[model samples]
Target: MKHKKYQITCPYCDSPALFRPASMVHGSSVLEKGRYLYICSRWPACDSYVAAHKKGKRPMGTLANKELRHKRMLAHRALEELQQSMHMEKWAVYLWLQGHLHLNEEQAHIGLFSEQMCEQVISLCRQLIRTSTGTTA
Candidate 1:
């Protein structure tokens, strides 16, 4: 296994988290995969979870529910698009986000973003993309 499990708390329901195989959360299709999860004990009802880090017994970030998870993914994709379209390095893009979004280095991580913050980042990314591509429309 790549990662070990650790206890965490779910932000949504304030429930303690449980360490389980990814299959438990993602279903049996992922049973053979070597990933772990920290899920809310009140799952199904609370529906919050986070993936573990590959190298250690730590979570990737604070546990979030499905809606926040989707927003995070979209926010991450927006950052990726910015990196490619602007020909910026990953660190450079993060620095750019920190500046444009008024976030500190720690708060700039997409995993820690709120839905509104994710939307703000997406908008900034779009602006950068349009500016770099020289296509306002």
Candidate 2:
């Protein structure tokens, strides 16, 4: 069976973002050359983009602005810290988080999360870390 291409949209502007090579994304800026992403056609004005998988056209997440991107990064770091301290497989961590967030397997991705959801993940992971370490707030 043929798979459908992922559709990406700018969460901020609600505009249709297009998938293109990173080289064509920002008119010769330094942005991890050779990668691909879905970028808003409005570009610098819209300031939203979503990275695609290294080898495919599939988007890793919804399009994000600078703030959302930073939150996502923080959420990822928190998850990483929790995973390391708990000595759990990444998938196991994801499964637990998905259950906590009440998301289905296919819909439970940090990258696809909104800024609020990212913050929730970070907060929950910090709590998990403290609980696992037997430390009290």
- Per-residue alpha-carbon lDDT of model 1 for 1-137, expressed as tens digits? 55544667888888899878888878878453878788899987888988876568578788988888999999999999889877899999999889988889987787778888989989989987887789556
Error of 2 at 100 (Å): 0.8
Please report, in order, the local distance difference test score of every candidate based on alpha carbons: 0.84, 0.86
Candidate closest to the true structure, highest lDDT = 2
Error of 1 at 74 (Å): 0.4
- Candidate 2 wrong stretches, greater than 4 Å: 1-5, 24-31, 135-137
In TM-score terms, candidate 2 sits at: 0.85
TM-score per candidate: 0.87, 0.85
- Span of ten consecutive residues with least summed lDDT in model 2: 24-33
Could you tell me the lDDT of residue 102 within candidate 2? 97
State how far residue 77 of model 1 sits from its true place (Å): 0.5
